[model samples]
Target: MKRNPVRVTRAAGDIGAQLSAWRRMQSLTAVQVAERANISRDTLRRLEHGDPGVSWGTVLAVARALGALDRVVDALDPFQTDLGRARAAAALPKRVRQ
Candidate 1:
């Protein structure tokens, strides 16, 4: 399957911007959050800029460090997705066509 890098990159950038804002709102410095997440400040900076070069674990750790891990988990929860529920329903054949 083909993937669109632009869309992915844009999403990452948006998330990073939000994260950066959250850090500021919580009066956190990059070093503070990075220390909490057990990552380097450089890594945290890359994440904040939405570089997409960081590990998924690092992303989750960042969220955890900021006490927003629940949001991250909810974002990826398939059961909470209406489109997924609709598509899953469509996948099940209600009657045999043959």
Candidate 2:
């Protein structure tokens, strides 16, 4: 597989770190989180270490287990931002034919 871009790697690391920090703040162990997420401890370790090979479903499961699923969903909502709301108002064509 091709290597990920630097920005992607960096973002993954940051996200992983945040997840780890949250777990710590909640006084949860890796084993506890793994069980809560229905994933293995190794998988949780890889996620906390920012391994880009992890699946999106696994990430969402972990976030949900941590009670952060709503925050994650909100963060990805474009309409939550001023620029995104403005762009939605302008409305692009339904289809683009090259």
Candidate 3:
């Protein structure tokens, strides 16, 4: 079992609201989304509310159900992140010709 946090970032809340809005726009109920994601409605509720206790798999599943899998995939892509790239470059012992 995962422990939930005391607070979440604004981005987390925004993402949750966005996911909820998208589900509403697609005419999907929480039960329907949960069924499609093979997760319980309660779990989906936690995920939709941005509870940190929820697994990334559950979040991805919900994204997939909402046809936003690409967005989630892109979000995890290292090349898509400047901070990640900078950190990787900084960690290298030798500098590569850019």
Candidate 4:
């Protein structure tokens, strides 16, 4: 199935908003986070606004700086199923078909 890029962008924006909220909750200013992540304040602002152009590495760095990397990783998973070996085996075609 085709994925919607717009939806992904919106999701990223939502995540960025949440990150900003969390940062505010911790009383850390944008400058502080930017400095800690070794990124520019402008870049950090763009990240907080959910700009789609922000690099994943930069996002990770900001998350790490805020002590929120684990939370971010936990939130961004698209596949978390536990199908196991049985499921994989069942998906294969029959020997005759192969």
Candidate 5:
């Protein structure tokens, strides 16, 4: 199946909006967050606007500055639940012996 690039772009924009909203809620300016994250203000602006060309490390730095690194870790954590393990195991095809 083919995926829609436009839909992916929209999702990225939504993520950027959420990040901007979170930063605003914390009473921090883009410059402040960018400086603390050691990123350029323009880079931060592009990220906030979902430019899609930003690097993963830049995003990670911004997230860390926003005190959202824990949430990112939680989202990627593999051992949080037994159900995930079961699902992963079930997805593997059984091996056959000669």
Candidate 6:
């Protein structure tokens, strides 16, 4: 009964799969990753299974444990894409007054 948009669900699944692939590529077991991320094995399993309810902190912790934190952070850089760059160059609203 999750109410996430289809795109969000798909993105979660992709990210989960990629994390699993990274763990396998590094020869790290689930227990090792869970310990390294300082999270419970159940949490890691839920994250790896693409549960969108996983916390952002948990995602960042897992990424850091897997040495992919930089990549994850960089992927959010607005200046990295043409559209983002263009948007950045344009004047944007500072804040909306309620």
Of 1 and 6, which scores higher on TM-score? Answer: 6
lDDT of the candidates, in the order given: 0.89, 0.93, 0.83, 0.85, 0.87, 0.92
**For model 1, how does the per-residue alpha-carbon lDDT over 1-98 read when each residue is reduced to its tens digit?**
55559988898888888888889999999999999999999999998998866788998898999999999898898768999888878897889888
What's the CA error at residue 22 for candidate 2, in Å?
0.9
Give per-candidate clash totals.
Answer: 0, 0, 0, 0, 0, 0
Q: How would you encode candidate 2's per-residue C-alpha lDDT over 1-98 as one tens digit per residue?
A: 79999999988888889999889999999999999999999999999999888999999999998899899999999999999989987897767899
Q: lDDT of model 6 at residue 52?
A: 89
Candidate 3 Cα RMSD after full superposition onto the native fold (Å): 4.4
What is the TM-score ranking, best to worst? 2, 6, 1, 5, 4, 3
Candidate 1, run of 10 with poorest lDDT: 1-10
Off by over 4 Å in 3: 1-9, 81-98
Q: Per-residue lDDT for 1-98 in model 6, tens only?
A: 64999999888888988998999999999999999999999999988989889999999999999999999999999889999978976857767689
TM-score of each: 0.79, 0.90, 0.69, 0.72, 0.76, 0.86
Candidate 6: what lDDT? 0.92
Tens-place lDDT per residue, model 4, 1-98, is: 55559988897899789879888999999999999999999998998898878899999999999999987787655343355446656876667653
Give the clashing residue pairs of candidate 6, or none.
none
Stretches of model 5 off by over 4 angstroms after superposition: 1-4, 78-83, 88-98
Best by TM-score: 2
**Which candidate would rank higher by lDDT, 1 or 3?**
1
User: Considering only N, C-alpha and C atoms within 3 Å, which residue pairs clash in candidate 4?
Assistant: none
| lDDT winner, 1 or 2 | 2
Task: List the candidates ranked by lDDT, beginning with the highest.
Answer: 2, 6, 1, 5, 4, 3
Error of 6 at 96 (Å): 24
lDDT of 2 at 9: 90
